[model samples]
Target: MTVTERRATTRAAPGPRPAQPPRAVAVGVPRLLYVLALAGLALLTLPVLALLVRADWPGVPAAITSPEALSALGLSLRTALAATALCLLLGVPLAVVLARTPTRAADVVRALVTLPLVLPPTVGGIALLYLLGRRGLVGEQLDLLFGIRIPFTTTAVVIAQAFVALPFLVIALEGALRSAGDRYEVVAATLGAGRWTVLRRITLPLAAPGLVSGTVLCFARALGEFGATALFAGNSAGVTRTMPLAIYTAFNGAGVTQDSAVALSLLLVVVAVVILVLARAWKPGGRG
Candidate 1:
């Protein structure tokens, strides 16, 4: 091409000759917003500080390590672990259905799955009792057919914990699944991957953060369960009286002293903090 024609073409094509202003790197936070945020943080943290201040520090070890406290702690740990497993086994599938299905029925089902979250723990306990008690509809049939009773048993504690905690797993994982989308799953399917393969390899891996977070929440919630477990499982030491129930028993003067209750409460709070810290440090595939 001629030099003049080449020069004209270069002018026609867009040029990056204009000098641009540098962007400001610093951002100013409003004083009012910072004050509000600090207030919100203080609201959450003050109670923890108060509990620490009021606790009998010298008696903590005795209170937590006493045979009765040990029994209750063991029971709480076992039941909470069982409930977390149950949540994962059931909640994962339910979350998948909720996130993947676009139908109105899915919405209804999601709300139903979330019902226990909004319901008072006592109300949930009562509901579970009616549904699984000796005279209950299914409970009666089970008793008539197999002589199996569920209420006030160790199993009942697990059930109560699972009932309340399942929603946490379901909600967290569902939100994760929905946000991650299904394009990758579809692509994998087009490449001859089966549904299970896609889920195990793609969907779940992508949502592992949410799954881990949900599991932590489930475990924490189950460990701290009180009202529902009290009503549905009955506070029978070693069998169903978990840490919360033991704490209650102590606080109410039925068993250990108030110092014991305070110690147990502090222990529970410590465990929750540890779980959260561990969760934050976890890295999926060493990359997350």
Candidate 2:
């Protein structure tokens, strides 16, 4: 191109780029959506705020320090941690299967895996009771062969919590796996890496964030489990009565006070908040 023609073209070019939307517009596009979004945020947060405001702060120390309350808290933490471990051990594999397989059977498996999420907790309790109760299908065999009874025990609480919490872990990890895609795995395999090695070194590391998130969610859910534990585990103090059961007992089960219930509820909320904060602070592939 000639110098003069190039100069003329440069001169005729758009002087400045068109102005983008103003900051306010960028922040608040679709005014209705913005309002609704704020409303949704408020709906989720306000209840917690109210709980904090209405908490019996003076009675908290006494209530939470009570023997019954202490026992329930200890049991809740233990079973919830156990449930989280179970979810991690089992849910990760289930998530990998769901993410890697696309067959109809996989779909059925996925549906069955997620059934507890939509299923009422009470119904899930009944289902677990049928499967693991003393006279239940597999339960009967367990009793006959090994003399193991599952219901109305700490083991039952763990089982109930795990059942309710498994789906959260699986769903989160499966989403992460799907989002990560299989290209990295394929590449690793092409480079002569074995299946197990690739998974342990590449896939799982990539999905660590999801795994952590899912595990936290699982712990929180398991900690708060009520209906299933009530039915399958029974509300026996120091045996199966978790924090939720303790709170319920305080509220409606004879010989307990509302202050105790509020205190326990507040304690649960604080624990959940701490879990969230810890999760957010976690850095994948970084030093703790």
Candidate 3:
């Protein structure tokens, strides 16, 4: 019963297993993705770098100081800011509706609101013309009744930019709204707070970061807008012309220095970078 049986039992017990190394193929997908992502980043970044490299540093000051350039920049900033304001005014409510509503119409409306994001800016410009031109559908009525023709003006520039950029604000705000927990609202209501009071005091504060990021993104996009503004507003210097339009004009003309365009492009790149950095630094209560 003795030594032989004990030895056999002891031998039958499991021994320490050797550790296995991770498979090379197991890590391949993520490595491939990393490489591809880096490649994409390089491709996107190179053009901006090239623009900066091509820019004449000395001429940049002169070019930007020129009346044409200054006017374009000023107009671009004004119109872009106006467009961002319009987006905030309209997009926040749309986002709340999309986030809270259960109806099928809400889905459709949300989709419609995002349509501009996918649509070509040129096509959007043309659509705006059809809707608001002197002979356009309701535009004719406005022309006759109020003597208002919206095309080829600063207002037209703002409208076009807003149409293109509104989707960004809507998407951002919708994401924030959905991510935000309703527990605060419930607590506020239990404390005798009204819907508007809760929204103003609680919801908006919680969603501030997303709102700020979206506004920055919308403004950046509006600032860089070329196709819609050019087409709808007509690229007239000191009137409808913006920074992007000015860049295009400079690129097209023999007398115009290419460095001027490069400098302007660099300016946009810097602005985008600053906005992105600020967005990354921002934290809102609802992120959790």
Q: Record all residue pairs in model 1 with backbone atoms less than 3 Å apart, i.e. clashing.
A: none
Candidate that scores best on TM-score: 1
Candidate 2: segments with Cα more than 4 A from true spot? 1-27, 253-256
Model 2: lowest-lDDT 10 consecutive positions: 22-31
lDDT of 1 at 244: 92
TM-score per candidate, chains pooled: 0.90, 0.88, 0.86
Point out where model 1 deviates above 4 Å. 1-18, 25-27, 254-256
Ranking of predictions according to lDDT:
1, 2, 3
Candidate 2 per-residue lDDT over residues 1-288, each given as its tens digit: 999999999999978788888675444478788889999999999988887787778788998899988899999999999999998999999999999999999999999999999999999899999999988989999999999999999999999999999999999999999999989999999999999999999899889889889999999999999999999999999999999999998888433397678888988888999999998898886755
lDDT of 2: 0.92
Report lDDT per candidate. Answer: 0.92, 0.92, 0.86
lDDT by residue for model 3 (1-288), tens: 799999999999999999999777743466788889999999998887787777788788888778888898899989999999999999899888888886999989988998988888899988989989998897889999999989999999999999999989988887887788688988999999999999899988888877887888899899989888888899998889999999899888764477777777777677778877877776665352
Clashes of each: 0, 0, 0
Worst 10-residue stretch by lDDT in candidate 3? 279-288
Q: What tens-digit string does per-residue lDDT give for candidate 1 at 34-142?
A: 9999999999999999989988898999988999989998999999999999999999999998999999999999999999988999999999989999998788898
Ranking by TM-score: 1, 2, 3
